[model samples]
Target: MSEIVRKESFKHVSYLWDDDEAAKLAGDEVALLIYRSNLLGADLRLTNYGGGNTSCKAYAKDPLTGKEVEVMWVKGSGGDLGTLKKSGLAALYVERLRNLKNVYRGIEHEDEMVELFNHSIYDLASKAPSIDTPLHGFLPFKHIDHLHPDAAIAIAAAKDGKKITKELFNGTIGWVEWQRPGFDLGLKLKQCLDENPGIRGIMLGSHGLFTWGDTAYESYINTLEVIETCATYIEEHYGKTRPVFGGNKIESLPWEKRKEQAAALAPILRGFCSSERHMVGHFTDDERVLEFINSNDLERLAPMGTSCPDHFLRTKISPLVLDLAPDEDLSDTSNIKARLVPAFEAYRALYTTYYETCKHPNSPAIRDKNPVIILYPGVGLFSFSKDKQTARVAAEFYINAINVMKGAEAISEYTSLPRQEAFNIEYWLLEEAKLQRMPKPKALSGKIALITGSAGGIGKAIAVKFAEEGAVVIVNDNDEARLAKANEEFGKQFGKDVYITAKLDVTKDEDIQAAFDAGNIAFGGIDIVVNCAGLSISKPIEEHTDKDWDLLYDVLVKGQFKVTQAAVAIMRKQAIGGDVLNIVSKNALVSGPNNAGYGSAKAAQLHLSRLNAAELGADKIRVNVVNPDAVISDSKIWEGAWAEGRAKAYGITVEELPAFYAKRTLLNEIILPEDIANACFVFVGGLLNKSTGNVLNVDGGVAMAFVR
Candidate 1:
């Protein structure tokens, strides 16, 4: 029987090259290639951050021989093409690289291939070349660009991928079946080029696309042409029928309402997905993600596999789809927990079976078998990862995958690489070794920390401390300007993407809920919560007004309660146990004269920590109190009327008051905000992993206030 052909009219591919700007960069070829790479990298539709590679070959004077020789300048490992600089491309002598293929007397292992590639580098100062260096090196073209564009992958991952490629590009493109990337795949690519000398591009079935030309513009424009052609094919054949969920579905809450719902659901999902170690949860209700989650065929379609094999590295083979009842109340903690527990258990069992069946005997052991993407019916999608940035990256890729899958299913049935092929990519020794070479994470790495009133003083110190230790910090404060400043400073110190900021009023329930949601969305979930938001009010018992009492209690006691409640709900749901540190005043234990309202509310806050410890110990949640006495350095709390009052009461000026307080301590040391932060870290950093309901004093040894 003759095969049915699917024809699609070609669409114009957009180019982003700017000749005026390109004129400013160093070398003509290098500048043009960098410009082209940034153009491709800037568009997530073309290629996302660090997801694709580009290269150009030029003749350069060989230092030792003083003869013109070919050198390949390819995108280096660990560099993003979007913001690529000339230095981002690794330079290697093309002849030296090609000669290594002759040196290859069939190696028994893949690691040896990587070693051989490393030794071929011509410049010692250049960054390490990407693993696909050989593929670009062997191809007989002046310029080459390889990208896993969603449009191309949609066509490449179909059941009749080869037929589709032949029909679309006809005589101009060659198609290769899926093969694990290494020396073998590189050799096969060279063979394909040699056999199809007239072809301009090659489509790797169940992989991605590669296009090349004699010039940078030719190669870049050709890549866009291929992708645009595939996109047109999907559009023409698919008929633009939007995916629809068939059943009588529960009405989804609005975006803002769903965020609140996510905050409630995150903890439960985190707990269910967690092992002995905690896993953070990030929630997204993106329009595309919502469409996928709401699809009637979601249960069948979502679990098939990733849109491309590269995605398996981030999202794993498949996402875990939850069978959430339409009528179930997501606000009810008990109901959500009950539903997630069984769903998680089933997912674990299925994951174990998949791993056992597909993984090679030599495959490295799985890190954490939990699914990275979690599709919660009414709540949207929750992505899990060791840290916030990784979780966000996974979400970005999965969102793209969802769109690709939908597009493929619309045109033809969406298909992916076989189970074992995905397993090979996931456990590939070359990829695994890259991760092994990374530096060890800090003590609190991958943990998410939320600090209230983090704009200055002790709160700010704690935020910096946690961030320095590799925790994804959620900086919360009512002061917008200071919060932005803090966010910028943290970003400057640790890449801006490391921490997120939330403008929050701890006393407000909506603010508390929103902050938690932001943290959950930024990272995966909250692991540590520190309640350090406070204000000082000193007055005699009879002189204290109701307003003064209310403000003091609202911030110190009630505010702490609400934030803790939100955090505890998430922690309990994540089931990975967490730590809660309350920054209480030493007045909580020893009341000073004329400080009735402040001391009383602080005392209440201290006792509340004990109550939470007792209640949440079974859940493995630890609660402790940090009682800091008269912290004077870098403290905004001691700058106003409260400072003058305390100083006057101590029979000294503000400058002398610090010394007075220091002498009161048996150790005679002035307590700094950092000192308080250190004590706070001891509890939240798991130094007291076995202990809770404890009070750690940072008063430089205030004998009376110290708790034994």
Candidate 2:
């Protein structure tokens, strides 16, 4: 028996399959395949994000023929296994797939082969099939799994991987030489399987593991068996190769200290990364990253690049390492900035050379030359992408690569995929076509914004608008309950990574700093600031109290000033021009009865915006005004005494206040929070992007409030 078949239980990797869960879907092979895939994908040790494919062959009734047909259900292209669902699996006609061999011209017609997959699709509702569909279809097994488990890949990427596979799995596992994944690679997998009838699986050279069986459980268990056995073998050899990664060359910073350093460097690195196109960033101080970066071999291995296609496709060909002495202070950002400029320039030049050296006549043009993954020895890793989730997954994939490198170097000499081979995969025509099909990025795609008082009212509306247009938002509000609900709402609307929340009381400088600090660290830095935090009191000049004036000025005038100042400092540091929007009022321009403290504070806020706009224009920071009068829906202020105060000012009941305000406007329409939000988007959403130090009113057209 093959060593993998003889193994009854796992020794290294976790056996996550619960018989009860499997029994619930026993009759459905496709559901069982999805269940097994999720279990394997949930563990990063098995596969990185969107890294592997799984499939099972099953009998399905043909709609037109009314007869059972052999069909293949495989994970679709760009689908994550852990989150795989019925919609994520592509259904293909197995007999049709098998017949494609007659038309398979050769590997040179790979792109044409992908087009043929459309012809073999069994279900119209099915997602697009993956490139590895042929790898599973050509095999004889009823079920199959192709995973990039670190341990197996360690064996696959080792110099003596083929030799290691023979000894490790005995006769049960076979091996194939390195080839980029495509129809040719699929044929090689089939050849390996046909030649070794008794083997349970094959190891794809410098790539990953392939395991199969008759049933879903059998296939899933067989995979765990192979991976766990390889883990056990690597561990035994790893013991002999003591001091992994040639031992850590520098002591890792304390967890808190490392986070502090990461926060400081994130924006600076993000700024450099945004040279070609603005990029959002994700930071990680995970122990895996800390250990790898602090190691002596990191300088040697990180530059050599990642072995697995999954790793390099996300992390790029090589990482840009920002090494520092043990005693060097990262707090001196200027010093770090000086080093990063040259480092980024050199990395871009080298990447361009790689493209020039390996370009084929029809190869895709060179992509973003900036390093996707950036390393800071004492801090951790920072990954930059067009959006939050991509940036985060890039970091996670790099961590997986770190594990693979550690294992390979422990048991055998680690070898990266050849640069030419990597270049082929990176610029493949099929991959380029996939990228082209993605929807164009939104206006605020790579920008991060901070919107104060964002738990509700105009603030939340602005936050939601920005998030919709593809900006990561820092939503700030002082109300704990409202903030939590906003968090839940935003998480449900947009995936959780798109926005973050912070408790903010605009009157307090500490709270202001905390919010900005949270914004800077969570998302590289804030490129847009909207100051909408305010409360109003409609009182006669004599009746206005010291408490009333202080509160109004605190939130409206002074608070907006402090937040803008903080945002500007970071914007200047980022060297990327930004947008500053203030939510002033009609009261700032037009004098009205029964208004003293609130109107004066708003007037001060209005002038402060224009003055800052005048000075900050030199920094390319555009400060503008969105004067929204009587915004009522979902407003915290309108829900409380402010409504009563405003109603009293108009000599009307609170219920009649909406109509009273609307009647006064030129358009005779009630102003909604969303209306203000739409106006805010106009200023920063690249529409009125050039018009700064200007005012746009969103009050259903209050004629007196027009900008001077």
- Candidate 1 lDDT at 422 equals 78
Off by over 4 Å in 1: 1-14, 26-28, 86-88, 105-111, 240-253, 494-497, 540-542, 659-669
Tens-place lDDT digits, model 2, residues 1-708: 443444445667767777778889989999999999998889888888788999999999999899999999999988899999999999999989889889989977877888899989999899999899999999989999999998999989998888989987777899988888877778898898889888999998888989999999899889988898888888887647578888888887787777667666677888888888889988888888888899889889998999889889988989999856534676666887897788899999999999999999999888999999998886788899988889998999888888889889998888999899999989988899899999999999999999999989999999999999999999989999999999999989997789999999988888887787777677888799999998888777888889998988888988999999888877877888899999999889989987888888899988999899899988889999989898888887787777887788778899998899999999999999889988888888887767888888888888888876
On the 0 to 100 scale, the lDDT of residue 358 in model 1 is: 77
Clashes of 1: 12
lDDT of each candidate versus the true structure: 0.80, 0.88
Candidate 2: lDDT over CA atoms? 0.88
Q: Which candidate ranks first by lDDT, i.e. highest?
A: 2
Residue-level lDDT for 648 in candidate 2: 81
